[model samples]
Target: MKIEIWSDVMCPFCYIGKRNFEAALAKFPDRDDIEVEWKSFRLDPAMPEVPRYQENMYQFVAARKGISYDQSVAMHEQVARMAENAGLDYQFDKMLVTNSLKAHRIIQMAKTKGLGEKAEERLFYAYFTEGKNLSDDAVLTELGISIGLTATEVKEALTNPVFQHQVEADGAEASRLGAKGVPFFVIDRKYAIAGAQPGTEILKVLQTAYAEWKKDNPGLIHVRQGNTCAPGNDCTN
Candidate 1:
């Protein structure tokens, strides 16, 4: 089964989704048969690179959501606690707010180089936790190299704008499909699951999707070398 996920690195719920989905896969007996692909989505494509003071970021979100500052603070704390419970140290206040269009492109490049999952995680960590500027091509190249791809290769790919169009196309398709928000999952391009749903919920979806795929393939599995990078899945698939 191939699961395609559309999410933005800066979206807190996307980080939660990643953890929840991973936890679900950990409990599966046939985890190795699944292939997960990270699709590009931008939460704030118009945002510019800037050092955001913690309070300002919250204010920005609150203003956009038309919520009270107090409610925004509460939401921040809630997300922080949830992230902590999932073994992620979220530093929302220290985060650097920036556009993610190029970052999504970098993730696409990483996918071509077989570092898609790591790039996905690293991008989330860099944006929401480490306070890195996702809009910066230089920073993205460096991060890609750190994950496995060569820095020169990353630079070349970024300069050539190889995956930028594809990333934008993914976002367009998601919007065309009526996706208002992200952390959305399309299992085998049939079943759709939205938001940072619970691990058990994810498990149910995976099981159902895997069963459906099995029914069609009839005892065949999709396991291949370098399929999807996780704890056990081959990345070649």
Candidate 2:
């Protein structure tokens, strides 16, 4: 079972969707056979590396959506409650409204070394909970190092144009998949679930997709029965 998820680090629901998917996978019977890949999706590709204004997320949202600051705060409060339910701490007040391109670049690099999940998890926590700046090289380096990536690797990811190209490629792929937003999940390229759905919903899609995948890629079957010891030395007939 292969699951590809498209998400942005700064998206609050993307973090929540990650938690929900994890909870679902934990209960899945074939969890050991699952392969998860995190893909990059930029919510605001043209956003400056540093915000021109010293506004928090609430203010930024208000300005972007033409809503009042109080309304934006209220909306964020609702999202914070959702995060709380997902066992996350979202401090919108402290969140920086800046570009996530650098963070995505590091994640793209981490994917080559099989540390993609760790990179996504750490980035989400840093941005949403700790209110760290994803656009900062120092912050990204610290977070990447904490997730088993070397400082040199982090620096390379930040400075290299190849990583930026990789991020753009991922976005292009997402567009081809008809994804309009973050937290989009594609299972085996057969089924897709959009938005931050509940664990039960995601698990249902996983089960259905796995069943179909098993049918298409079934291995050989035993012609004769034999008593043998399994890998752990447990004998079964």
Top candidate on TM-score is 2
Per residue, candidate 1 scores C-alpha lDDT tens digits across 1-237 of 888899998899999989999999999988888898889998777666653443366877788789997898899999999998888999878776676777787788888888889999988888778878766777887888889988877776577665787888889989877778989988887788899998999999888988888899996845545546667764545
Candidate 1 lowest-lDDT run of ten: 46-55
TM-scores for every candidate against the unseen true structure: 0.86, 0.91
7-67 in candidate 2: lDDT tens per residue? Answer: 9998889999999999999989988778999999999999987775434888888888999
Off by over 4 Å in 1: 51-55, 219-237
Clashing pairs in 2: none
lDDT of each: 0.83, 0.91
The numbered model that scores best in lDDT is 2
TM-score of 2: 0.91
